[model samples]
Target: MRCEICGKKLVEEPLKIKVDGSIMFTCKECSKFGKIQREAPKPQRPGVSRSSRVTKRIQRPREPTEEVIENYRDIVRQAREKKEWSREELAEKIYEKASVIGRIESGKMVPDLKLAKKIEKLLNVVLIEKTDNDIRDEMGQSKLKGSTIGDIARIKRN
Candidate 1:
């Protein structure tokens, strides 16, 4: 499909989704201006109803369960530990408050899309695995240069 904002091409990948049913359809480069207004459903009326009766169906946005959010936090924390990086080190690398990292790892709070992407890039792991529900960062895709704790250790020696 084409980008809703730039009209550019869109690959078969996920996009960042907001709680209000707003989906970002373009690449991250074009996401800066991909603000599409959410269209509300029109009210419906039953033909059999003689009286003036309008039925409106209100759809609530999807919300991640507490358990699922906690799972994501654990995944991030485990990835960081696998890298043998302390909370302070990760915080410094991601340019976030150590307390924020601590809270996220402990499942005290959920990271916004931007913060989640930052952690994923710095940790070099798919902390937030893609599901039917996830904000895709096409431009922020990163690969571990050489994974494994040994490789990381060797890099520090140089």
Candidate 2:
């Protein structure tokens, strides 16, 4: 290729172009003279990237426990602080009374299963069911004869 303008070697730029609705290759200098429009590279279809094949590990659900409860409270408190929410505002999100949330945080009550689950969901943390007793006696149906109703009632009432 030679430069049409200066007769210099028009290094092999091999410009594919369109001229008068036709396509061909020419030197850059000639391209400028002809006002030839260069063909734009075809847009490539995006491939399935290797990253797409990489699978993320599924996180196992954590067992709920006392530690989970404390951690959950801490997390909720932190989020509430970051969001600039009063305890009342946070309570609104969970449809709970702020005082109840306060009681939970202060460890004044062990949340029952349902309340614990609700708290866990609202706080985005696990806060219950970590320890499980498997022994049959734990179910309170032991073969051994248990104490009398009055004794049991007295014990329970206390």
Candidate 3:
């Protein structure tokens, strides 16, 4: 080990000292600049093993997540038409560009949660739905193969 302040190699045992309210391992010469501190033993649970802790974490329930509906583009378009609002008008109400509205309506782009919520409120349409985490877990368990990186990336992008 090396001294924190001087960066000198420590041939002997390093001292634990408190300098400016921070604990540091310092050489004997540098330790004189700070108050010596007593090293405390780390506390560990008596019966817990690393594998048991991992399994406990894995068994924890996942929270339900929200996702956009498959027919969101059609729903948004029909709702906006029913309200007799132009694309530009709807975009202005949602603080988005007309091009973005056009792309979403044309099914070229998928709106994120925040944008979908804004459009849903303005047009009074249901575009997002909550998916049960337990259902997803069951599906995942039934699949024989693991998800590839591309599949994971696609999930993340959405």
lDDT of 2 by residue, 1-158 (tens): 65444556756775655667555566775665455643443324344333222321112223322333434455445545656778888778778899977876666755666777675566544454333223335445233113323322432343
Candidate 1 deviant stretches above 4 angstroms: 1-70, 127-158
User: All predictions: root-mean-square deviation over Cα?
Assistant: 21.1, 19.0, 12.3
Poorly placed runs, candidate 3 (over 4 Å): 1-61, 133-158
TM-score of 2: 0.34
Question: Whose lDDT is greatest here?
Answer: 3
Q: What digit string (tens of lDDT, one per residue) describes model 1 on residues 1-158?
A: 77655677877553443424456666556655545323443335455232223331113223422212335576677778878888889999988888988998988888876787787677754434333223223333222222433433443444
Decide which is better by lDDT, 1 or 2: 1
Displacement of residue 90 (Cα, Å) in model 3 is 0.1
How close to the true structure is residue 112 of candidate 1, measured as C-alpha lDDT?
A: 77
Task: Order the candidate numbers by TM-score, best to worst.
Answer: 3, 1, 2
> How many pairs collide in each candidate, listed in order?
1, 1, 0
Ranking by lDDT: 3, 1, 2
Clashing pairs in 1: 16-135
The candidate maximizing TM-score is 3
